[model samples]
Target: MRSLMLASLLTLSAAPALALAQPGKDCHLPGTEESLRCLRLAVPLDHHAPGAALSLHVTVAPALRESARRDPLFLLAGGPGEAGSDLVPLLNTTFRKVRATRDIVLIDQRGTGLSGKLDCKPGKNAETATEDELLAETRACIKGLNKRFNLYTTEQAARDIEVVRAALGYGRINVWGGSYGSRLAQAYSRLYPGSVRSLVLDGVAAPDQVVPAGAHDAQAALDALLKQCADDTVCAAAFPALRSEFDALAARLAKSPQSLTLPDPRTAETTKVEMTSMRFIGTVHNILYSQADSRRLPFLIHSAYQDRWQPFIARSNVSRDFSSEGGPAMPLHLAVVCAEDFPRLTPELLAEDTKGSFLGAPQIMRIGKMCETMSVPAVPYKEPAVIEAPVLLMSGALDPVTPPRRAEAARKYMKNAQHLIVKNGGHIVSPLGCMPRLLRTFLDQPGAPLKAECLNEIPAPTFQLNSAGPQP
Candidate 1:
């Protein structure tokens, strides 16, 4: 069944490439099987300074039709460190309808992808590393970088997008950004309104909302999941003590971190890991990103409370490692957070937000310590201005990081925009059920009424009652 669904999604016919205004070569993006055109544009390292320049990697997935639309869709990646080109598979599947009539353009942000990526060694395991050890690793990463971190801010990346647009000879392109990319898309629209015909922001990170504020939001998501399980007959009967079990497990781990040996999820080699309370909660938080993985939470917690650590450890390892693969480059991620989001966070605000939350103040404070070594000054927080372009905002009701409230806050500043909240969706709902078709409809006629009734048909996530999965 899964294979059939994938075959259906990949059914779009590819046509011969159209003649480009600028030079480019045929290449394959990392995540997709389709051939695409790749190009590199060199921009000044510092837009203000007259010195060295770095080449930005750009990939163009041409439309399936010979005569495509004049303006293409530019996809901005999340993480503030993720490469836009890395999102090809997602666009190829979810936005295939949009790709049928319009070209899709992806540019690797300055400090990520094949661009001048700030490569750094992965930090020691958070569960095992001491505070000093983590801080030392951060310092080493900073000392190893050759370029200035401050120059890679979102504002600068937005300017680079404009330059690429002109070079490619595109006029008033459509923009789609997810997560941090949603924030970047907004920045681009604000900076170059005339160049954008429409905007689609999924899982919005409002300009005024600091990155560390997610602690409270994550707590809310966990609470929602627990409440959902409680409401379900199968789940409630199977795990009647789910909430208390989770709380007791957290308290136990907090008092004494557990050390256990388990086979690696991928290699199946025995390995020892320290399961700290923060790590346990953090793993659960990460798993909540996908509704499928979330369904297994009740079972996972129940098993762990019964001292069956293998199921939790193996699943958590896979979840953590898989999410990090081709994800935000750590150095660039730090550069952006340290320069843009970290300074806005204060101890008072962190404490206030994290009070009574499972994800306490530790994670935010750790980031704060890393930011102390950064040379770049913080970019002052400013409310995003009203964008005149036609805008479509999407959010998942259960998003732990960027909740529906963030999209609600951003809608107030838009002159022409519509917000869609997916009742059963988690993070980044643009690619979910009925969303791809909705995207095509919106891009074709931004001001027209969206046929969004299909969103209401998306069923709520089912809980995993046992190893056999949800009762049929």
Candidate 2:
């Protein structure tokens, strides 16, 4: 009886033939099978104003076998600004077993990817910009955007997912969302629970988690890196006063910005770049995303303190994202962050959250203020999603961004779920050792115990004692 009801819900009164978007030979990831289909969906930019529409980019990689399951799996990307379809190659590779039976779907959300991407270029001298100067740039960004910025909220994105699901004629979907994508997955489940068959949240971000509060998590990750260096005999011996050295370097940079010719890692051409406290912190935050990257921190910090700028600059350049159009759309990031998280962050909240943290709250608080100034409406806060569908929650034990606590908090609301913590992992937990098999097992049999003991085999990143990195 339940199955029949679900089928009825999935097969909603069909959309008009004229409204149905068509699939054609479009985007494909490198090494993806030529058989994959690409689609361009036209969803409303503002649901209230049906006349205003936006074109969203989507790609579907069908099941490998002829006898495939009817239900498909939708993969959501992180970064409120991240292109959802970017995960296609990774999904195609990592979830190959699941793809043998289930089609994998990817939808670039309304404001990201080819879906009317909202790229904004802030002033070039952002590292030295005053609060007023930054605000002026933000206003200029708002003036430059062509679309209705207000409609790009998370709730609206959730609605867009439903439209895509209905357009493609999927009766049910299993969702896997990482980082910020996890939050969107929950929103979709809350709004359309019946459409979801199962849920997997990697780097789970609970609904109540204000975006700026993540500063604390980043600080903690840096602290963990410091502590690890302290505990490692080789590392401690190499840099006995690591923390003090870092403090001195930060203080020095804060007082006087250093300008150097940075050798482009890709091209040997030297480029002049300025290093300030803000720039250093920003670079550090990006590096902390992966344990492999964090392994370079101790060495990089020691080098920086000694005024050896080449290695530090080269390492910093590794995280740079260059695009034909500025970068991943910042307007989309602003739209989502302002509407969802920024409104809740008060001055008191900032003080309380950032206290004792090495990374100060200035950058995030400034963003929060930007959102406030732009007058982005707040989506009513809700309790964590109470999902009836079986869920798999994953987190990296060492993740500085979305820590294990987030998964633990989200686990409470899921009726049937399992939480897995990768001991040596960073922000992304699923891609680590033995985790792919565990994910496959969960998809094959939701609520079943995973044979994931192999996760223990993965070890912490070997600390680099010198320029040679970890010796074989």
Candidate 3:
């Protein structure tokens, strides 16, 4: 599910065999909540050639309570770009219930943080790169990345995982993935099926699915959000004119894609930019990560429709304090989306795809089109992980990135899998609300599994946008 074949083809420029190599045999996990450990385990940068030599990053934590511990839980982060090794504090808290029963592990995939990151610089801004600029930047980045690191795909990352498993002396490990993290979980299960005892995919992304699937799933999530809005008396009353208002906003933005200017939330710079349909979609898409975030959408749409640029401005503004030259990173994204999702898009499907989208698919397609120049063969990997070994699939009903449908589809592939869908939940639902305790119950007695009734008790999302009146 990655983007740059050109980037994958270039030879390393005298780079060491292991750029971020740290042998994990002696790796330590934190004893205190505040102290977390990260170490590099040498994995072949190219798994196809493991004996060729490369290094991978893996961080392990010994269980909080030694007696109740079962096996280590491998946490895979989404984005194929975002790294998970640094999220120990958050992960520990979210999975505390499970931690009491098992260790939580985080693996930062290649081309992401701390694992021989493919980026040239960290903390770069996205404000400067237009779609066109990003396309060019990606080509250059792929060339540069190929020279510095051998661009192995997710399949390679999975095999490297087994090495960590063997070195750690743990025969079995559990998996939990969110957003693009789901891709990692699927690949891991495919490559090292015997190594995994259980898998928990939050925001389940099916291995067979791609960008169009993602786009279609997000549209469904939006529909769910709209229904939630209707169910919320406060939200419905507050923005009864929501749908019509949304149409106006899109029509206006389409007429004048680049006329809008708002102070950048991160820098407060008054910058002129295109507020095209795709940007509109991009701006509000990730909010589906949680039910709490969904509650604020009505107000967001109403405000944007009403020419209240503040909502979009505040939401669209981003920072890169710890990101890897993160701007559009469009080039990498284009390569990935184009090959796996948009490449086979039919003309009619392409046209219909954007019909309902507030933003036309053309904008996303623009990136996909540009990516054709650097097309590479899709990485060879397994389908979604649905084996029957104590598997649990958790998804947010409103999760745009990986919707409930993905989980439902996974059920067919898995012999012994069961899914829990949080009605108002967005992306990662396991570590929050009632999920932790329910998960605790499941792991405490794997054979005597608790019915996922707690998920049923979870409340629906509150869809009231945070649109405030003047100084009220």
Candidate 4:
């Protein structure tokens, strides 16, 4: 009876579209006057069985010119849970150079955006939930999703994008993917090589690399930030013992976690939040994702060492904006990682991977515990994808998560791929410095040799020495 009700709800949830756009048609994008077309592509809940349905939301921003190329540029988002369509407006602006003569397409993958979401609620009590409670919640979520659980794999998602491409009447497509989206782009190219025209992967997370196996790289990013502080005369003079101060802060926090009353910037009300070793480490790790945020790390660490938790908490609150409106569906994140990445991780492999890294094993262990009960429907991809497309791989020299090394690893297998590193840049490199113009050039004529001299001029932002005033 419960199964029957779930099946009924699933069917009811996937209502018929008001007006489905036909293939090869150009119309106003839904909900806007923009020269774009929108449609819902019906995909099988399970690709192999083809019974119940799931709707994939696809949006296409047409070229400004009537004489545009038929091969559209497909943008894939990161998080393994972020909606690709959510980034359409941003891409439309950033890739305006390409938007002139090429259509930009955004598909909201399977488990995100307008598509049926599998969000497992993390309540106000989430921070204090025990491992057992967390696991139970995941198991319950899995039970609720039922067969829908099997449909959220990146492999299935890659296939779904192809279905949308064919339906939209595009013979081939260009793909630009960032972070986890880069992984999706590679998967699509590997699965359907014939459909690919060119590839742009920013913050490349290569196949065969396990998730959260990035702790070593993350540690390196933190080290690089400190090294940069030491290198700069103004920054070094401002915080002479920056490295020692950070080490002392970490050590002291490890021994005894601090409790503080900090002001919530939003409400201007005082709240008590614990500052633990794990939380501090995790916060710093998150800060390293961008060069902008990382500039403040030296100040934050120095302040924390001086027992001023207010600045740290204030900055951290800014970072942990866990609003519900647009978030990576946690269940989908777990499903994809558990299926594709975690299965490869063993006790030995994890220990070996995390050795000498400050992050240690807890991060990966937390993910492992959540996925104990989850089952993967298909075999994970074993080898690096051999993509023949005119691939342009971009990486940030200071990227904490998907470092430049991952791009190098990927380039080894790619036959016709050019790898570009943005020195002093963070996770995503395209938007930094003059890379957008370079990106536009790359997409315009992917086979042409890229002029990346502009990237050389983008020096790292000056480090934030003091919150009271700007650098001297």
Tell me the tens digit of each residue's lDDT in model 3 across 368-453. Answer: 54555556665443445456566678887777767788777766777767678877577778766788877766565554655776
Better of 3 and 4 by TM-score: 4
Alpha-carbon error at 15 in model 1, in Å?
A: 29
Q: Flag regions of model 2 displaced more than 4 Å.
A: 1-19, 30-35, 121-139, 259-272, 318-327, 372-374
lDDT on C-alpha atoms for all candidate structures:
0.79, 0.76, 0.61, 0.76
Question: What is the TM-score ranking, best to worst?
Answer: 1, 2, 4, 3
Residue 423 CA displacement from its true place in model 2, Å: 1.0
lDDT of 2 by residue, 1-472 (tens): 1112232333224542213465445455645656567767677777666666678777777777878787787888888888766676776567777878888888888878777787665456453354466567776767766556788988888888888777777777899999999999988998899999889899999777887777788888888889999998888999899999988988887788787666655567776667766667767888888988898888889988988877777765554321114346677887888888887887888888788776677656657655654577787787765899999999887787789998888878889988888888898877777787777788888878777788889888788878888735
Residue-level lDDT tens digits of model 1 in 1-472 = 1111222232112111111123576787778876788877666677667366778888888888877787789999998778987787886689799988898889899889888777654454633354356568657767777567788898888888876776676779999999999989999999999999999999998878888768888888899999999988888999999999999999998898888777755567787777777668878888887766788999989988988787788676563421244566767877788888888888788888898888887765766666766677888877678999999999999999999999888888899999988988998998788999999999999998786889988887678776676556
Highest-scoring model, TM-score: 1
Which 10 successive residues of model 1 have the least lDDT summed? 11-20
Candidate 4 per-residue lDDT, tens place, 303-390, comes to 9888887778767655342223357776787779888887777778888877876676875576766676566654556766578889
TM-score of 2: 0.89
TM-score of each: 0.90, 0.89, 0.82, 0.87
lDDT of 4 at 96: 77
Q: Which stretch of 10 consecutive residues in model 2 shows the poorest summed lDDT?
A: 1-10
Best by lDDT: 1
